[model samples]
Target: MDMIADFDLTAHNTFGLKSTADRAVLIDDAAMLPELAKASAETGRPLKILGGGSNVVLAERLDAIVAIMRIAGRSVNQQTTDATIVTAGAGENWHDFVVWTVDQGIAGLENLAGIPGTVGAAPIQNIGAYGAQLSDFFQSLTAYDLKTGTIETFDAEACRFAYRQSAFKSEPGRYVILTVTLALPRTWKAKRDYAGLDRLPEDATARAVLDHVVALRASKLPDWRVLGNAGSFFHNPVVSAEAARAFEDAPQYPQVDGTVKLSAGWLIEQSGLKGFRLGPAGTYDRHALVLVNHGGATARDIAALATHIRDKVRIRYGVDLVQEPIVL
Candidate 1:
C-alpha cells in the first residue's frame, strides 16, 4: 500500500466540503491490516478509518493517518434450507449489495434499498430505512482490532445493536471493519409495514419492494451526486408518550416499547425552516431533514445551517435534534 500525503477529501465526503487528510492509505487485503497497525503506531499520529464517505461531515481537515477501507469481495458463504448467508467486503457499496441479494432471490434486504454508504458502515449505525434495519439481517462481521493488531469476528448480539447505534459506534475508531455477513431468508415474505410500503399488495415480490423503496427514497432524498447531502441530517427524536401528546396533530409513530418516534422532518418543517438557506448551504426544498451543499459551499456554511435548524427545533419543541452525520 502506498501512502499519500495531504490527500484532498473534497470528493471523499458526500457533503463535498473541501478538506485534506494529513496522510491516507488504501488497503485492499485484510492481511495488510497488521502492518497498517504497526505503521500507525510507529508514526505516532492518530488513525482514522474511513469507508465510502457517505455518513460523515468533514468540517475540518483530518489530521491523522486516514486509512480508507477498500477491501472488496462478495459471495454466498452458506445456503441452508430456510436461509442463505452472504458475505461482502467492507468497501462494497451497500445499495449495490442489497440489489445483488434481491436479484439472487434473497428477500431480507429489499426494504433497505437506495441507502448510500459502504457495507462496513451499515452495522456501525445499525442503518435503518422504511421498516427494516441492518441488525435484522446481520449475521456477523470481521474487523481488524486496533489495540490487539488481530482480526476479530462479532456476532449480532456482540454488536450491541440498537436504534442507530452499535458497539462500533459506541467505541469509534477502535476497529476497522473488513467484511459483513447477512442472513437472508430463503422463504421470502414482503415487509410492507412502513407507510408507503403498506399500500402495496401482500404478495409483492422482493423486486417490487426494491423498486418501491428506490422510488420512494428518490422522491424524498436528494441524490448526493447532484446536491451533496448525507441523506437525513438528524435522527427522528423518540419521546415519551406524554410529551408526544402535546403535539397531537404531529406525525408520530408509536414504538412497540411505548415510546413515540416523532418525525424530525415534520418538526423542522413545522419550525418553519423548510427550504431555509444561508449562503450555499440549505435544507433541501423537497425534504427539510436533508441539508445540502448547493455548490460553492464551505463546511462552515453547512454547520451553521444545521445549528440554526437545531436551535429552532429545540426552541419550538422541547426535544433536542441530534445530528446524524459524524462531523470530523
Candidate 2:
C-alpha cells in the first residue's frame, strides 16, 4: 500500500470537485486491506474506499483515510454449456472491461458499455444502462469485509440488487469489493428494448451494440474528463400509479410491481431548471438529468445545486428526486 498524507482528491473524483483526504492509500492488492484497516482503526479514522471515482461527490475535505482501490486482473474463469464465467479485478475500468468482453466474443455486457466507474463499483448501485443491468450478468463477487476482517464471496441473491441499489450500498463502507464475476451468455440475443437500442437491427452483434451504446452516451452525456460531471445525477423516481397520473405529459414506464417510473430529467426540465446555473454548478444544457461543474465548483456548490433541483422538482411534481452519485 502506498500512502500519502493530506492527499489531494481533486483528480480522483469525476465531479472534479476540489477535495482532499487526511490520508489516502493506493490499494493495489487485496492482501493490503486488513493491515490498512488495522492502521485506520488505530488512528481512529474511518476507512473509505474509492474506485475510479466516477459515481461520487466529494466534500472539500474528508477526515477519513481513503483507500483508492487499484487491485487488477481479468480472466475467463469457467466455461459452461450455457454461459462463460468471466472474472475481473475490482479496479478495472468498466468501459474497457466491456470492450474486452466484446473483443473476446463475449456478449451480455454490450448494452452496459460506456458507463464510467470501476467494475467493483457496479454492483454497489446495480449499474445499468439501456436495457440491461449489472445484476443481469453478475454471477458472484469477492469482497473483503471491513467490519469482520474476512474475505467473503457474495452471489447474486446475496447482493439484493434493486434498481440503482444493492446491499453494498445499503451498508456502505462495510465491504471492499475485490473482483466481479459475470456469466456472459454463450448464445446471445440482442437486447433492444430501450429507446436508442430499439433502433438496432434484430441481428445486431455485441460489438455493434457496444458501439451504438457508446455513441448514444457520447451524444447524451458530457465526458467527465472534459466537463466535470457524474453521468446521471438522479435516479428516475418510481412513484405509485395514482401519483404518476398527476403528470399526464411526463414519460412513464410502468414497473412490474405496478409502480410508475417517471423521467427525472423531464421533471427537472419542466420545473425550468435545465440549463439553470448557481455559481459554478448547473444542470447540463444538453441533458437535465446530469449536473455539471462549469469550473472550479466545490462540493458545497454541487450540493446546493442538487438541493435546488430536488426542491424545485418536488414542489412542481410532488415526486422526490434522489441523487444517483454517492455524496462523501
Candidate 2: where is the Cα deviation over 4 Å? none
Error of 2 at 40 (Å): 0.8
**Predicted candidate 2 versus true structure: per-residue lDDT over 164-268, tens digit per residue:** 999998898999999999999898899998998888999999999999999999999999899999988999999999888888998999999999999999999
In order, how many clashes per candidate? 0, 0
CA lDDT scores, all candidates in order: 0.89, 0.92
| Clash pairs detected, candidate 1 | none
> Which ranges of candidate 1 are over 4 A from the true structure?
none
Estimated TM-score per prediction? 0.96, 0.98
Candidate 1 per-residue C-alpha lDDT over 1-328 given as tens digits, one digit per residue, 9 for 90 to 100? 6889999888888888777888889878888877777777898877787887888988567878888888899999899887899999999999999999888877889999998889989999999989899999889999989988888999999999999989988788889899999888887789998889998899999999999999999888888988899889999999999889998989988999999999999999999989999999999999999999988776788889988999999899877999998876
Model 2 TM-score, all chains together: 0.98
Model 2 Cα shift for residue 117 (angstroms): 1.0
Considering every candidate listed, which one attains the maximal TM-score?
2
